[model samples]
Target: MTVTELAFFVGASGPVTAEGTEVINQAIEVQTEWSTRNAPSMPQGRENRGVSFLQQIEDPSVYLLTAHWASVEEHNLCIAAPENRETLSKIPPYFQVDKIVYFHLKDVAINSTSGKNGEISILQSPIISVGRLTIAAEKRQAFEQAWNEVKGILEEFVKPNVVKNGWRLEKENETTEEFVLVAGWPNLEKYRDFAQAKDFERYQSVLASFAQTRDLKCYRRIL
Candidate 1:
């Protein structure tokens, strides 16, 4: 299955100024270029891949680097390569490394009311909400089942307001059980409207039953 890898980076000490943001964006662009040139030969079941960079709207000091790979093994192979590792190691000076997590796409629910595509992109949407949770190991199955049931409801509830909605499970992590849900909207007001809706509360309640902790934040595309 396809996997999405997310790396969160926090700015050093003080607030990240405009200059700092520019530097970080440049670094990400450079990294993308270098990775594409130095990528190791792909193993079986690994072909399509891409990467993106995002900055938090509420907190410019936080950035999220996203990678879409054909599969987790493919991503691992690239990470294991000496050239890739060396290139990646040079990125840390741009920001403080917070955490790296991987996720496998579970399902995607799209609202039928609008003709707009559900794919998340800055060109298509102005705001994005990233909801992260650590689910109990024993309840993983139940959590996924609940998501299957709730995703459609979520799609209907948000209707034309949401551009994209999808869920993903953590690929592998020893410290915690994590899952990520991302929703895209045309603007902050529309997103805030969804947050304040009763359906969102119900959705959260269902997730809370299986989750140990949750963190949700909004981000704007920077590059």
Candidate 2:
């Protein structure tokens, strides 16, 4: 099944205090509860699959809030709901909104045990390296082919400690076709080790050949 992800980028206007953090966390919990409750009946027969709140370790004040839905239409339905809008309205006062991006990513390739019963928690590998890219229009097919190869290579390198290495594509067309790759590692030490390895170099080389624009960042799961 395909998943639609709504990503919210936000940061504190100033240094976030203990109280501010608590408020943000509570707000997220409430929002998730509401969404989960309304998921089954949402438009387009959508389901609220999951929700996560991530904080950027490099910049503690910055955060990434992601919610997974059955499809893009379902996500839009939730957004259009008055209750959902009300919950969302409560969030902005707590932080400075940066930008919001939506991705309708289908899991094209994954490990055998990716979505099996024994799934690793975000807390296990709190650090997630997120790579976002826009593929050159003419090279889309080639890029996807290269991605399949890259996924196989990553399976060999980022295993055990690296619980998840997921690749997803954006359904909507921007200036170019967009994709996101999220690699989860136990800690910065493990992540750095993988990055410095030869396999990572190969991965980067393969990506560079077809990627028109690439942006990479790291974030820690806070909720």
Candidate 2 per-residue lDDT, tens place, 1-223, comes to: 5463637555557445666566656655655565567664432211233456677777676666665555666667767767656656655666665554555566422122455455544435567777778776677788888888777666555555333333455445645777677666667887777767767888879988878788877787666
Q: Over the stretch 85-158, how does candidate 1's per-residue lDDT look in tens digits? A: 66566555555655433445532322122456653442235676788888766677788888877777566654
Residue 78 shift from truth in candidate 1, angstroms: 3.5
Candidate 1 least-lDDT 10 residues: 41-50
Work out the TM-score per prediction: 0.70, 0.77
Pick out the ten consecutive residues of candidate 2 with the lowest summed lDDT.
Answer: 41-50
Model 2 root-mean-square deviation: 4.3
lDDT of each: 0.60, 0.60
The number of residue pairs in model 1 that clash at the backbone is 0
Which residue pairs overlap in candidate 1's backbone?
none
